[model samples]
Target: MGRLIRPDGLAVGERVRFDGQVRLVLAVTGRSVTLSDIGGTPRAVPPALLFANGDFEVVDSSGRMPLPPVSLLETLPQAALERALWWEGHILEVLNGLPPDAEAGTEPKPQYAPSRSL
Candidate 1:
């Protein structure tokens, strides 16, 4: 078995091939890598799926190859942003159950409230 590679280490705009398909490396981390499909959709792939190193190339629409700076936040689309926010909310809910920290002794705010009418 191959060791896992950090997805965040991959150069932005670096092309890579995985599972017999080609994709652009958007982000890399120790556990997984984020890639952009040919259609420009971002997908997360585990290191196990990455087979060949040079199987892909970095190229733009003009075929000129260049590596872009890694910006994970910039790569997130509206839908992905929403999903991340939702998951974060769930995590916060779990954290709220724990005892308050020394700095702050209040619990998290309620998620929902009864609507008041005039």
Candidate 2:
């Protein structure tokens, strides 16, 4: 038996060792996992049998996954854009004592006046 690793967290393409052999993970579903041997022979087994008593260990982690990109905030829907703009204005009012689009000579909001407690 090998040291325990989180089998449920295994990803396709990761290499794991068990039964004195190293296999490449092919797929992981809710019920079973598919693995392939070095000869390209495939085996499907229940996670329970494969990981019984922690009989498996991750040998290679070259399949590490990356988080998806979410750098486009300006593409938000109209409602989300409005809400984001409202929150930005509110935050700017609180931090700068004036709304983000306030005119240069406009007076600060009474509740967020910079002359007050800061």
lDDT of 1 by residue, 1-118 (tens): 3444334335545666664576667676767778866545678866655633434333332321233322544578978766765665554345444222324665444542123211
User: Please, what is the whole-model Cα lDDT of each candidate in the order they appear?
Assistant: 0.51, 0.68
> Given candidate 2, what's the lDDT at residue 63?
26
Candidate 1 colliding pairs: 6-28, 6-29, 6-30, 7-27, 7-28, 7-29, 8-28, 8-29
Runs off by more than 4 Å, candidate 2: 1-5, 63-118
RMSD score of candidate 2 (Å): 15.5
Off by over 4 Å in 1: 1-9, 52-118
Candidate 2, position 53, lDDT: 34
Native-referenced Cα lDDT, model 2: 0.68
